[model samples]
Target: MFLERYHSIQDNKVLISARQGSLFAKEVAGDFNPIHNPDERRFCVPGDLLFALLVAHFGLSRKMTFHFRSLLGDSVPLTFREDDDGMIRVYDDRDKVYIEVEREGESTRDQSIIEHLIRSYVAESGKNFPHTLKPLMESQGVMFNPDRPMIMYQSMNLSLTTLDAPEPELELGQATLVPDGKRGNVTLDYRLMSRGKEAGLVSKKLVVSGLRDYDPNTMDAVVEQFYRLKEKAWD
Candidate 1:
């Protein structure tokens, strides 16, 4: 699987190195969030990495929900456990849970379906910054620090009416960012369509910490620089 390079599995435990996580963010997800930079002092693993791994291991379900509890760093050993109820949990050495995945409906082991869903969902989710997020923050009158943007994935859930259709696609429906002091919670509602028909709805939550007052000029510069880096990467 394409996800093998992002993590290592040994003795039923998995670990994602900083370099691997950084590559997955930039190369796979096309996300350039500073928090995923390997050299950053507070670098954290991308939640999308965890999401990919979960599906790769257990296969894709018609309806799924993931709850993130804590951020995982490089060299942290994570163990996966699933109960009889079909709930999967990823925990660290101290028994601290990092992520929980609940799946319902039928699960498919078809690699093609799994990879297609992974690629499609990650691509849509990665467009958060500088695209969907910029307008959302503007409406809320708050934004993250331009120097050190700290946006983190909080949770995500999707309910699909049918997974039988092919060519699944995601489209942003609505979004809202609610600020609480220097922190804010972003709720993005999206719709999943298959062959031009709506098949499901998804809700993604993100937490932006270390926020500051929104400055139009500063935000404009940030958005410009973001695309510059993206362009430079592909060039």
Candidate 2:
């Protein structure tokens, strides 16, 4: 799932945060583990770290592997590793399901459910979306910029100018955001989305403007909100 990690372990400590996945982990399976919760012991250290690492490695292999209270009462331990060709392979303790990362250079013409959903969210959002076709949409640290959250927005195309407004507000270091896929050519949305549904769409308006004519106060508020709710799409 999104909360898995890939460790290049030598002794015990993580050699590097090689793969940091920050996405939603599913408990779709029957036997979801208690440790997956935020309050579980060392939850922050192990759970988040592991998930981030898995995402960095797995990309989008399975549907975030959710196993909540298996058909039988059993705890399923998560497993991860790389194959000879450097593919990510994962298995639940029960071994009922398995996910193997596609070869690195393969095209995503055939993507998983989650990958499809993510693509859908970006595609419907409007014109000039990334479609993420070129050099790959993902990267380290640069995936987000508090000042310009939409830089990585999987737009369908790119434009000389794109803008959004209504100046939504969010807590410091964050903001509420939604995918707004229905809104043609959107950089961001003021509304928040229901994470329960992986990909929600919205229709709204965006405007292009000059930096000098822009108000820092409004931008600051919207930027903060963007940071807070970005993960949810509307945050």
lDDT (10s digit) by residue, model 1, range 1-235 = 8998899987778999999998898888888887787898899999999999998888888889999999899879998889677789998889999999988897788887788788889988789998898888898888998888888888999788876658988988889999999999999998988889998888999998888888999999988887887787678
Candidate 2 weakest ten by summed lDDT: 156-165
Q: Which is the leading candidate under TM-score? A: 1
Worst 10 residues of 1 by lDDT: 158-167
Tens digit of per-residue lDDT, candidate 2, span 26-84: 22111112222333442211232332344444443322331111111112244667668
| Shift of residue 174 alpha carbon in model 2, Å | 30
Highest lDDT: give the candidate number.
1
TM-score of each: 0.94, 0.21
Q: Model 1, residue 177: what's the lDDT?
A: 91
Candidate 1 Cα misplacement greater than 4 A, ranges:
84-86
